[model samples]
Target: MSLARENRIDLVRGLSLLVIFVDHSNLSFSGALQHSRGFCDAAELFVMMAGMSAALAYHPASGAAGFRATASRTLRRSFKLYWIHLLMLAAVVAAVFLLPFIRDPALVREWSLDKLAAQPVRYAVEAIFLRYLPAELDILPLYMLLIAAVPLFFAAIDVAPRLALAASVALWLLAGIFHLNLVDFSQPKGLWYFNPFSWQLVFVCGLLAGLRVRQGQAPFAFSKPLFILAFVFCLVAIPADLVIHLGEYGETTPLRFLISKTSEGPLRLINALAIVYVVFNLDALQRLSPTGWLRPVFAAGRNSLPIFVLGEILSDIVTVSVFGREGIPLALELLAVFVGVAILLGFALHRDRAKRRRSGKPASSLLVASQPEPDYGPETTTEPPSIPDARPNTAT
Candidate 1:
């Protein structure tokens, strides 16, 4: 197999992040893609890809010394995410208070910044602990928690891979069965919107897949019957959710509650895994040439952290300004999304240029090829199975 770094992962990740921003914006006609309409969405894509990326980057460090190296990197990244979350929260707080003073009072009520202002001290502390997430702010803390625990996953896999996976599944089932989850300080009755206990199962699933890939094997066994079953499930799930409105039955259907997003329901996991299977086996999105038109997407994926933060900020702006407002056509809201993506692309380009400058590279090599990545896949005669410890893809 070719050892080149997988551009498809980056490409899919970038698109997923953008899709998330649009989905959160509540703009008209923006729900055409993945999310809400089904059991899966960008978040699933993000977490799974993160797991794969982590395995690719760290699995070689599976033994004693290597484990330390992987743990150190994981810890450094976890801290970085913590700091980044704090900065983003601070910015959101600033926006919450500043927007109304500078522009419109409606924003204060509209964005729900008043409560935060009312108890800044308490909320600030709570926010630090990820107990005061407003909206569009929940995913990062979950990601941070997962990243911190990745070394544990590596250890578990080293001991007995199947047993590790079973443990993850058991935790998810227990969380669902007992309604166990992280509590929200802001709303004591409510739980963390993206329950980490449930979500970790998905992350672990990805970890296993990535480990298998690293070992020069298909992530899952090729089972025609299994593929057909997953395929039928997807076929039925989409129309059930979108057309028949089956998800609405959750309130009435006792068993349906287990499929809820809050608990990271079992159906959601199945749907996401099915989608992932289709994507990997079909090479559905892997066909893009590195130098093709979608290179900006690769760039965005490469710089996902900054792009995600920027997208969240922009989504807030759209929520208050365009969504639910009269005289604002769907096209205009879509235009705003287009503009938001363009800005992200520009930011990525600027960062690329800066890195080149820092390296004292001449102008000729400034435009680095987005492809030609160091291979982290399974072995081949031409190259080693493992890639060197390069700058880690730190985004989740």
Candidate 2:
């Protein structure tokens, strides 16, 4: 079977990134609207959408030829993530160092060599993408590890997808119950924003969803009943959030905690499922129409990595400078920042597209070639299989 291009997935991803951009800028606008449970719900939806997109992108194909192709493709994508991680690390360090020179010395006092040295060697190791870093650090390190783990994850699922998923869920539950924060002594403050023990389940869920989608087993596709059920679930979640107050629940409550994506809880799983249902069932979203105005947003989605990095950097600057202080007109400032980032992302995407066009290669073909093949399959499903890490495909 051919790999179907899920336009709704792209739309969900596009919307998720936009919402996350605002959420990450909580210091700016969203803080003012902290009482808005809708905003919190939106953030949850964004995370869910991200996981769904991953599922759609990397679901495995059937047979040996398809599996090999998928593995090769996954390796290439992982390599690109590695490069992105390296660039982000360098950029973050440079930004931290330069802040003292560009702004007040006090602005970077937290990043002093003495402060950094006080942390364990594991911090440095985690900083290089082996483990979780401090909360103040960017969450990219977790993503790098997740991308690196993709091949192994896929291989394991190839042997027994259900068993692998069950184990992942069990690990997540165990980590919560026992407060099992497994640290690679090589990496410091190993439990950062994206705790591996908690977050791996999200990735595993995505992998399972992808496998289901590939198998045409997803129940949400083009179904009115599924759509209504998803809608009802979303409606129920709102009141449940109010009653449960998920934020108040600590790690002791694994099921409650996981649902709270902000706290890396299981609720995130339901949120992701709801997002998948909504997107998959929306008939209008399945078709891609090449309109001039929308070309940029789609482009931004296509080249999400660099754009996301730039957005983060820009958000950081805005937060530390104007919005970081109290009494700013947050809503207006947020609008301005969002518009500014959107324009910049649009321009960057357009330029990149132009460059590609000039090179006489179809952008879609390049995108496909750049992506690694899906490696999860019936023959290869197991837990933590021995598959080689995917390499980056720079040609795209």
Which number leads on TM-score? 1
Question: Model 1, range 190-286, lDDT digits (tens) per residue?
Answer: 5777778988998898888877766666666667888888778877777665542323454445535645666666677788898777667655465
Clashes of 1: 0
Off by over 4 Å in 2: 1-4, 32-76, 101-114, 117-126, 129-138, 182-190, 215-226, 236-263, 288-293, 323-327, 355-362, 365-396
Candidate 2, residue 95: Cα displacement in angstroms equals 2.9
Which stretches of model 1 miss by more than 4 angstroms?
30-37, 60-62, 101-114, 244-247, 323-327, 352-396
Residue 196 shift from truth in candidate 2, angstroms? 2.4
lDDT of 2 at 9: 41
Name the 10 consecutive residues with the lowest summed lDDT in model 2.
387-396
For all candidates in order, the CA lDDT equals: 0.64, 0.49
Pairs of residues at least 3 apart in sequence or in different chains that clash in candidate 1: none
The TM-score obtained by model 1 is 0.83
Per residue, candidate 2 scores C-alpha lDDT tens digits across 37-120 of: 321343333333344444545545656666566566656665666666656555655665566533434444422223343573
Alpha carbon lDDT at 57, candidate 1: 62
